[model samples]
Target: MPAPATPEAPAGWDFSDVVGSDSSLRRFLHGLPGVDQVGAEARAAQLGTRSIKTTAKAFALDLAIRMVDLTTLEGQDTPGKVRALAAKAMRPDPSDPTCPPAAAVCVYPDMVADVKQVLGDSGVKVASVATAFPSGRAALDVKLADTRDAVAAGADEIDMVIDRGAFLSGRYLQVFEEIVAVREACTAADGREAHLKVIFETGELQTLDNVRRASWLAMMAGGHFIKTSTGKVQPAATLPVTLVMLEAVRDFREATGQMVGVKPAGGIRSSKDAIKYLVMVNEVAGADWLDPDWFRFGASTLLNDLLMQRTKMTTGRYSGPDYFTLD
Candidate 1:
């Protein structure tokens, strides 16, 4: 049985025995129940078709805005651009102060300080993507350094991608150790560690079974959140894949009494799509995961769509995309 939570595993459960060795880690991961692709897909499809009342739609729209990780991970991202993004995150609808701010603003590590400056005391978190980012191809030291630099720069959260190559090649222990190491690197000099969001890049995992394994691996290795994608890969954050992940977290909480957040980054830009995810979270993971602290969307354009939907719901007319800041 898993041990109760320790200082290392702060989520109220520890899996030291499961990760004690390469053989044991592999055995436990492989022993996990396989995914039923057909059922998962059908369930996700059915959930996607379920409609909420107008009041709930309004609530979901605001909740989605609050759950957004308003991300910009391009090479051309500038400090000024990040500041504007941070401003937008702080006040998503300036005209409508009733509108809720976004949960966080995600950028590359170098820009975490800029975001922090703009978001100071706003309660909006500064999340930086580290560990080689979209491609987790760097060495262990390089990845840890990347994480430490971001935390040292005042990042509240670190989104690190797991090495898909190591995972696919059966180097489960290597991947686990890397996640654990990066989790350690999130600590600052004063002792506060940024919450670690472990991205599986599930599209490349190539199977629902792999998604399930990756979820457990991340949670077992002490990731505060298990994310669906890095938002660079094609087919990022599909509903079926997210369903599998939600199921994993639900089962995990039951077994270990710890709740891990889920983030479906990329390709989820529509308000309708975001609401479907909210519904699924309620059904699969229960109401606890419905909060912004327990769920997030890692999209850049999703905020605009949510704002437009919120305006429509309140005023009975849809706001054009041009109405909001393009950034």
Candidate 2:
């Protein structure tokens, strides 16, 4: 089959025209090229087998380490726990200062201040999950308040979940407006708005086509990054789902000249699995997206594995799992 047509936004594509009404947004979203489920899965599986050489493997491992968003989003999260996580984010390996810090440390809004205290000037960002994260079922006002609170607490990035009920039920405009509002609520300190990461919880989306549409929808609404899952759902961040999302961001930039990021969260545990994602990003989204800013792995346990691999590669001996803190 011929490659899918690019939903390249028409030159000078105006956001207002598309979001002017439910009908307009629906028409544009539904008209986008349909996803080929079989093709996407086959491509993801094929790319997963590509091998990396020893030298490149070392670099890719470190790059993957840097791309990780070390996260601890639990109901029992305390200031002490948040502080420890922050420490780990800043220094994945206490023994080696060469180990680059993770891209950010993600936590609940209430823990942002505690994390900030530990990560001060250390370069590890404080990312908070807001807008009724993991479950975007609350009212719009409640969600906006949640977002504002996180930003006020110095969150560099806000991860908001979309109202899947609205999207699946054909309330695309409502979902669009919610994202727009949450993005607005992401106030920044230095005149730069906090980056907004829109989470689709792909497993809940049910199909590759939905993933593509949701990815486009989030980007169009000003999401700095489009994320796969909240890690609370089953089958989160599968390679096929991530492949579809990467394609959306690639095509979006082609049309709008705007670069959006992609994050595949949850279920990615080992260094081997993380490297597969790196290969996919390089192959599917191009080399420009290989950086931590353009892509991320929202994970808790992934960092530890990357540390272990790095240790083995440098010391020529596998430092058993106990060598690193249990993230």
Candidate 3:
């Protein structure tokens, strides 16, 4: 190796400010889901803002994405209502040709077989939630049993939420240990098998520093994907939170060379918003990982808007969200 060159500033490069300072750390901090400041108007402003409409190209990148568990969606999902929503979410209709091919159908573990049979030879995988979703407050034995049952039922992917209450209340070790055991459980029951996405419910965490730490903790604990929000929380999946996670992914990649995935579930209501997320990935994580395998948007309400946008792009006249049916 050549002798180390003296640390000299390259022309206009300013190292004095960042070479060794808290400001560097702050700059990293600033990048995490800076969403509190970006309200709906700001998000609206980002519309017509360079969208990657779901097209053959968008679907063709090396990776694949499945919109998991849209039926058990938050905001309006209730007991009697869930089954119908789950049924409709899995149903395929003739009118909506613009809908992208979901890599899998995500459902409550009970609905896995229903979706599996309905999707039939279409090759979409089946995913199920485990470890007591929405709130991961179950007894460890119960949670493990839940995981075992879902896998035994043939779920190809497992989307699990971490205990946010425990994580935020300074029980980091508890969360870490839980994820490790759950991951191990997945392996034992399903082979080194089902993909594990550890949902952080990032909206509930008070700060991005916490988000970064949680991201690291989840990945370190063997989570295949680190996700944002349960969509049940008040502030699920905003651009800023996602930005923070992407930066975390970047740093994690640099540090450990592990290519982790990201999922931004909830509140993604339109193709424009989805594109903004794609923009964040391009700008932050680079074009190399732009495929859906590395990123996903989880929302029942979003697919319609993405279809409407796709329709308008080809025909040049927009159809309102209402006119564009979700079937």
Candidate 4:
């Protein structure tokens, strides 16, 4: 028998627009408007000045809490560590039950089982960093195995790092194909497939132009979400870099009628900073992207800051770091 037919693209959508010969891909990416670095930075800085207060502040705080991908990706991470992280994710503020739980708990592939066991049926998701996470230097087979193992271990989402080496070397097609392959590897044996978030590690990509191209490349290659960084680099995530990514997702949705998510990991630690990011999302991607489903913060300490601020809002006083559990 012939091979099974692949599912059709969404109505009025065409994958051909993005997939093509190497030359065509280059032309397409190059044809994209060049990034005005100064202008982009100025805009991000300007948006950062917008002051959210009172009721709006409260709303944004809660939304930010829910959008967090409570993360712990470290050489020292253990099952005990992951379990503690999951507990914090389930109840971010021990003093107040009204504070919403984070959207997901992110971990390394080997720890997904522990996180799942801790979370049980609380509806919090488990996100795994795979595909030779933090460094996409492994063989393709190893990467795929890494992704499959995470999914089999019950990860609801997979954050895969793209081959920046291939991308910077002008091997755009290789990078795109890698994303597609890893996305496929997210499938579970029972026919379920975890959502795939492709990390561009824009810090190493070196230019806003490169960031824009990588964003489009990942989206075109079937990444359910295009992420800013892997949280291990110098400039893991920045307002300007994330602004460029948000624009890509917004534009992709306008053209394809398919909305892809965006996650900005690393460097975002304060409730104030998180709110500023929320403002950027609203202005750049519109209210549609404000929800946890479309946007996520890949953070570890960000949750605690949000909790402290949340307590301040509720009790009219700032709670020290001691108030929250140390995960």
Candidate 3, residue 50: Cα displacement in angstroms equals: 5.0
Model 1 lDDT per residue over 1-327, tens place: 121122223345678778889899999888887777888888899988998998888889999999999999999999999999999999999999999999999999999999999999999999999999889888889999999999999999999999999999999999999999999999999999899999999989999989999999998899999999998998899999999888888888877788899999989989999999999999878999999899999999999999999999999998999999997
lDDT of each: 0.91, 0.91, 0.64, 0.90
Q: Top model by TM-score, which number? A: 2
Candidate 4: list runs displaced more than 4 Å.
1-11
When summed lDDT is taken over every stretch of 10 residues in candidate 3, the lowest stretch is 1-10
Sorted on lDDT, best first, the list reads: 1, 2, 4, 3
Model 4, 100-186: lDDT tens digits are: 999999999999999999999999999999999899999999999999999999999999999999999999999988898999999
TM-score of each: 0.96, 0.97, 0.74, 0.95
Ranking by TM-score: 2, 1, 4, 3
| RMSD (CA, Å), each prediction | 3.8, 1.3, 8.6, 6.0
- Candidate 3: residue pairs that collide: 32-244, 33-240, 33-241
lDDT string for model 3 (137-173, tens) is 8998888788877777776778888988887766666
Which residue window of length 10 is worst by lDDT in model 2?
A: 1-10
Model 4 has a clash total of 0
Clashes of 1: 0
